[model samples]
Target: MKPWLLLGRAQPPGGGAELLLYQRDSEFSLKADNQELMNSRVYGSEEAMARLGCQNLGKRPGARVLIGGLGMGYSVRTALDTLGEDARVVVAELVPEVAEWNRGVLAELAGRPLDDRRTELHETDVAELIMAARGDYDAILLDVDNGAEAMVREGNNWLYSLPGLTAAHGALRRGGVLAVWSAVPQPAFVKRLRRAGFGVDEVKVRAHGRSSRKGGAHHVVWVAKRG
Candidate 1:
């Protein structure tokens, strides 16, 4: 059996906690204070985050997408694979070192997604990006902070708040999809989506691929559509 080796540590700009990156043979993981945040091997839900949103757009040329949380670049790669040639994917990563990890050690994990010409990397908060844009994106995929529950960063709760949900609604084009990945279900969030003028649908996906449930935990992704 191979042991997990610590690759590096990153200090989040928010200045609350430190993120530790570890590698175990071919797989990698990001954790904070010994709490597992994201794992490279269990990315089915992350891929679903992009798939469920981009599928709503249906190969639209020049579709613009915003992905929050560049964990291992799974969602970004999935979006690139799901969208058309002219589509642009803007990935907002709060932690700078995560991007460096993707470009360096973890590049091959998601097929070096950041290297794609259609993809842009923003070393900023996704909330700020959502607030700054108006009807700008065809889809907004958020796999940040274990979803609406908000574990990694205390400030990430804003992304799931009523105002944040409203910002996401305003940031999307008409009929655009806002996909969110969560470690657990929050019924209040479903209601907030409706209050924010989004038609919401929820899907439960295994952390590992559908072929097997590596663990019993099932992650949920909320596909909220703006009209």
Candidate 2:
């Protein structure tokens, strides 16, 4: 088979994989292996959106957020729901197409993540945003570039590295939260979160499938509070 330009992909029910095909910039869907595409959360699921309210200290005011890697917009949608009107959110997406694809085909799948008025989409690397926004955000979410281990791109390694983690540390306000998503548990990444001066809480969040009164599938969502 020819290497078609895939716009988006996800693992469907019963471990089946689905690919959003793109030809001449038009999006289509086809079945593929689970390993072929990137992983994202269910936009409308309660479990995936839980972090929004849990991390928000209070309904008082003055909460600002910066989200790195606007995967399917589930995180952003979740954040918007939890935050107050005073809150400001900046969503940095490295690949504009990912953001575009979300609208093109996966719009309903991922939800219209960029449609929210409170959300700002930046067509740039999250690292640059991390570096630029020192002590500017109350929450920072890294929901892009595969898991923390990184499979899609190499530069994402910096976000999980010592310096990268440190930059994230600087981007948050006091008691701010740095919520990171990973497909599997990363021990060293946990340690690095602590080393970066964050009171880390590693949340074992299952995928959207098994999410119920109990829990979902197997995944990691690191909630690190700025110290």
Candidate 3:
């Protein structure tokens, strides 16, 4: 068995726990306080989050999308592949080191999504972008924390609250979608999405790729469409 080598460490802005990066051969991992936040190997749900969110946006002219997290860059890359050439993807990442890692050692993991001409990187909180926009994005994808539970950053809780959901609802264009990634199912959050005037669909996806026989753990992705 190969050992995981520590690659880099960083502290997220606004005072949260420290983030650590590790590598084992071609695989990479981003962790916080001994808990794995994201791994390069298991990202099926992340890709699915973008796919399901933007499923209705195929070839839409001048479509705009916003991705809340840049973990391993799978969601952004998947989004870029899913949308049309005229689409624009805005990725908001709170941690500067995470963005740097995606550019450096982790670039190829998701085919260097940040380098895509359609991608615009924002080293700021996704909530700020969400609150500041009104019908600006055709789709919004959020993979910021483990789930609505907020594992890494306490400030992320607002992203799941009723107010946050309402803000997200306003940030999208008519008939736009908001897809959220979670480590576990959140039934109460589903109710909140509906309360915020969204039509919600809860999807369960395997953590690993379909080719993997083991059928890794199941993660939940909530695809909420603004009505």
Candidate 4:
């Protein structure tokens, strides 16, 4: 068996913990506080998050999307592939080193999504972008932390709160979608999404890609639409 090599380490701005990057041959992993946050080998849910969030976008030439996390860049790449040529994808990654890793050692894992002309990188908190916008994005996808539980930072809980959900609601255009990826199901958060005036749907996806015949762990993707 191959050993995982430590590639790089980064500290999230304002987060108490450090994020570690590791590689084993072609596979990669991003972890925080010893907890695996994302892995190169398991990205089916991440891809599904973007696909479900942007399903309504189709080939819309002017569609604009915002991705909250840049883990391995799978969500952004999937979104770029789903949207039209003129579509714009704004990626907000709180950790600078995560973005740097995507450009360096981890670039090929997700096909160098940052190099894509349509992507606009923001080395800031996704909450700031969500709160500052008004009907700006056609879809907002969040893959931050460990879902509503806030594994990396306690402040991340705000992203799942009523106020944060309201901000996200206002950030989206009419009929826009907000998709959130979580390692586990969050039933209470689903109620909050409805309370924030979004029509919500909870989707369960396999951890491995759809092409995988072998079954594996399941993840949750909450698709909430702003009506």
Candidate 5:
């Protein structure tokens, strides 16, 4: 086994926790405050998030999708796989270095999904994108901060807040889906989704894959649809 090398550090906008990039052999990881934010090894739930969200979309022509986090580009790439070529994916990342990392060190790990012409990279907050667009996107996927509870950035809370849920609801077109990834179950957040006018469905997925890992750890993906 090779040792993990620290690539670089990036701070989230508004002075939140600093994200550290590490690489070991062929794998890459992003960590913050001693917590593992994302790793290249485990991305099944992320892929599932995009799959279920787009699958619920039901073949909308020229579909436009917004992905909240780039994290190894798993969600974005899986979304591209599920949606047709006409589909456009807008990825909003809070840290600029994350985009660069995706284009650089983490490029091959995610098969360079950002390089695709159908994808647009936004070096800004996802919440801003959600607030700016009204009924524009067919699907919105959030793969941020250890799930909705968030252990990385403070501002991320708004994405799972009541007002944030309302904004996400407002940002989607009729029949659009809002998908969120979390490492643990959040019953309160489920109720919040309902209050935001979304028909919610909670799916349990393993971090490694569809089944529980050796420690019985599983992740939750909330697929909420509007109208």
Candidate 6:
């Protein structure tokens, strides 16, 4: 049972708490625990598909979106590729080191997404971006935590709470969509969106990257429309 060692941290784009990176070596024989998702880069494979399912919606011209995380920029890159030329994407990433790692080791890990022109990385918590949006976005995608059901950080609870959902509702324009990427099905969160005055749809998308195959993690995407 090797122990996981802390590698480092860095400042993100919009300015917020730093991203934490760690590695567990069997040599030390220490278990990583429940924090496995945060400590390791799970941006590839099924998670990438789960997080990027929003792109299935045909590109909307003049569409403006806010992305809640920037793990390896897979979601951001996918969005840029799917959206029309008139679209703009603002990424709210909580850790600067994560962003830097995306540009550094993680870039080589998942291919560089920060280099994309359509993305404006904000190295800040997605909560701040949600609070300040003010009907400015056509779509809001949240990938923070493991989903609303499982939180990686204690502070992230604020983002999935009632106030946080209300804030997300206010950020969207009429007929705008608030899309959430979850690792598992959370029917309660879907109900919460309806309570917040959104027309909700719990879409189960493919977990594998660009594939519609079976036998992979289900990407439970909560699609809610404002107004």
lDDT of 6 by residue, 174-218 (tens): 887888777778777777888888888777765554444457655
Clashing pairs in 3: none
Question: Which portions of model 2 show Cα errors greater than 4 Å?
Answer: 1-54, 57-60, 209-216
Task: Give lDDT per model, in order.
Answer: 0.89, 0.66, 0.91, 0.92, 0.89, 0.67
Rate residue 227 of model 4 by lDDT: 88
TM-score of 5: 0.95
**Candidate 1 lDDT by residue in tens digits, 120-208:** 99999899999999999999999878768667688888888899999999999999999999888989999999999999998998777
**Which residue pairs clash within candidate 5?**
none
lDDT of 5 by residue, 86-182 (tens): 8899999989999999999889876899989999999999999999999999999998788787677888899999999999999999999999999
Best by lDDT: 4
* Candidate 4 lDDT tens digits, 194-219: 99999999999998979998788999
Arranged by TM-score with the best first, the candidates are 4, 3, 1, 5, 6, 2
Error of 4 at 179 (Å): 0.2
Better of 1 and 6 by TM-score: 1
How many backbone clashes are present in model 3? 0
TM-score of each: 0.95, 0.77, 0.97, 0.97, 0.95, 0.78
Per-candidate Cα RMSD to the true structure, in Å, reads: 1.6, 6.8, 1.1, 1.0, 1.9, 4.8
Give one clash count per candidate, in the order shown.
0, 2, 0, 0, 0, 14
Off by over 4 Å in 4: none
lDDT of 1 at 202: 89
Predicted candidate 3 versus true structure: per-residue lDDT over 35-97, tens digit per residue: 999998899889999999989687799899999889889999999999998899999999999
